[model samples]
Target: MKLHGYFRSSASYRVRIALNLKGLSAEHLSHHLRKGEQRAADYLAINPQGFVPTVQGDGANLTQSLAIIEWLDETHPEPPLLPKEPLRRARVRAFAQVIACDTHPIQNLKILARLRELGLPEEKVTEWAAWANREGLAACEK
Candidate 1:
């Protein structure tokens, strides 16, 4: 198995954790996100989204960290990531989505880059990120 990812990508970090938990070791391939290596033609051919944490194995190419982790859980099944019960599993997934989808995006590398490009002041950007994180966490806690 091969994992194509940037070291600093949260999505990639999650996948790496899952792989470790499952006792699965994949060949690590780094794509420099800051240098736009992920947008290169060869990488884009495999992952149209140009995002990190793409796994190539079993004649399948998988993107999206959550989906990839779930696939690993399904295929490995030794140390399960999700609960066996359906409702509990749904709650777990929902909690993950709250962090991955709602919180992380607001302060992700790409979004922060765009914020800089748009001339947002550094202090303002920091404040925005903190606010987003706080709000998301508060909602998840509730």
Candidate 2:
């Protein structure tokens, strides 16, 4: 099993935590995101989306940290991260997605990088990231 990821990515961190909880082991391969290694041909061939924390195992290549965590829970269910009850499980997934999808992505590296490319000065870019984080947190608080 191989886990290809940028070491500092929160998404990758989440996947690593999940793997540890599940007692699953995988080889870690680093793709330096700040250096744009994820966009390289070889990495893109593995994950066209070029997102970090791709899991190559069990005859499958999985991307998106939440999806990978769900996969790990499904395939190796002994130490289930989600509840068995339907409503509880739904709630759990919903909250997790709220953080992973709604909150994190807004201020994540990709968005920040794009903001930089759009000619925003460093101060504005930093402000944008901070605003995104605060707004996302406020939304989650509701």
Candidate 3:
């Protein structure tokens, strides 16, 4: 198995933790997101979304950290990550999506870069990220 991701990416970090928890090992391949290495043709072929944390294994390439983690959990069920109960499982997934889809996307490197490109001041960009994180986490806590 191989993991293509950037070091500082939270999405990649989540996958790393999942892999560790599942006792699964994969070759680490770093794509410098700041340098825009993810946009390269080779990587694009592997993951059209050009996002980090793409797992190449089992003759399939998987994108999206949540999907990859769920696949890992399903394939290796010794240490289950999701609850068996339907309602509890839905709640857990919703909580995870709050963090992954809501908080992380707003603070992601690409979004921050775009904010800078759009002439937003550094302070404002930082404030946006902070605010997004605060609100998303607060909602999750509730």
Candidate 4:
């Protein structure tokens, strides 16, 4: 297995933590996003989304960290990450999605870049990040 990821990407970090928890061994291939390595034709062909944390498994490539983590937990069942109860599973998934879908997308590099391109002040950018964190935490608490 090979994991294509970027060092500072939170999505990639989450995957790394999952892999460590699962004790799964995979080759790590770092794509320097800061250097625009993800935009290269070869890498783009591998992941048209041009994002990090792509996992190459048996005859399949998984994008999206949450999906990859789910696959890991499903395929490698020891030390289960999700609770067995259906309600508990739903709650856990909802909590994770609060951070994954709600908080992460807004503060992602592309969104931040767009904000900067629009001449938003650094203070606004900081505020945006703080807002995302606050909202994500609140959602998790619920």
Candidate 5:
């Protein structure tokens, strides 16, 4: 198994955590996110989106952290990550999505880079990130 990701990627972290708990290991290949290594042609061929936390194994290539985590849970089944009960499971998925989907993207490197390209001042960029993080975290906290 091979996990292609950057060390700094939160999505990558999530997969690593699950892999640890499940007593699984993969060949970890880190693409330096800040250096734009993820956009390399070789990586892009495997993952057209060029995002981190892509898993290639078992004749399958998977991307997206949440999907990978869920696949792990489904396949491994020991020490299951999500609750078996439906309501609690739904709540847990909601929380995960709040962090992975709702919050992370707005202030992610890509968006922030685009902001910089659009001539947003550094201070303004920082402020935007802070606001996004604060708002998303507040929701998660609730």
Candidate 6:
């Protein structure tokens, strides 16, 4: 088993936590996102999305950190990462989607890059990130 990820990626961090909880060790491969190494041909072959946090194991390739984490939790159920009850699990999944789908997609490097390309200053960039985070947290309270 192998995991290709960057250290600071929240998605990668979730995978790390899930792996630790599962007590399984896969070969860790770090693809530097900042240096744009994730866009390189070799890594793109592994993940067409050209993103970090790609897991290859059991002759299968998996991308999207949440999917990988859920796969781990589903397959290795020793310390369940999610609640057991179906309804409760649904709520938990909604919460996870708040981060994975809503918050993360906005604050990701690609979005930031687009913001920068639009001539937005650093302060505005920070403000955008903070606002997105705040909104996500506010949604959680609802």
Top-TM-score structure, candidate number:
5
What does the lDDT come to for candidate 5?
A: 0.93
Could you estimate the TM-score for every candidate?
Answer: 0.89, 0.92, 0.93, 0.90, 0.96, 0.92
Q: How many backbone clashes does candidate 6 have?
A: 0
The digit string of per-residue lDDT tens for model 4 on 32-82 reads 988888879999888898888899988888999999999999899988999
Is 1 or 2 the stronger prediction by lDDT? 1
Cα misplacement distance, residue 138 of candidate 1 (Å):
3.8
lDDT of 1 by residue, 34-79 (tens): 8999889999999998889899999999999999998999999998
Tens-place lDDT per residue, model 6, 1-142, is 8999999898889899899989999999998889999999999999999888999998789999999998998888989988889999999999989988999889999889999999999999999999998999899988
Instruction: Candidate 3: count the clashes.
Output: 0
From the highest lDDT down, the ranking of the candidates is: 5, 3, 1, 6, 4, 2
lDDT of each: 0.92, 0.89, 0.93, 0.89, 0.93, 0.92
lDDT by residue (60-100, candidate 5, tens digit) is 99999999999999999999998889999999999998989
| Per-model root-mean-square deviation over C-alphas | 1.7, 1.5, 1.2, 1.6, 0.9, 1.4
Give the Å shift of residue 106 in candidate 5.
1.0
Error of 6 at 22 (Å): 0.8
Error of 3 at 65 (Å): 0.4
> How does candidate 1 fare on TM-score?
0.89
Candidate 6 C-alpha error for residue 132, in Å = 0.9
Question: How do the residues 9-101 of candidate 2 rate in per-residue lDDT, one tens digit apiece?
Answer: 989999999999999899999999988898999899989988898999989998999989989988999799999899999988887887787
Show where candidate 5 strays beyond 4 Å. Answer: none
Q: Mark the regions of model 6 whose C-alpha exceeds 4 Å error after superposition.
A: none
Q: Candidate 3 on 1-142: residue-level lDDT in tens? A: 9999888988999999999999999999999998999989999999998889899999979999999999999899979998899999999999999999888988888799999999999999999999999999899888
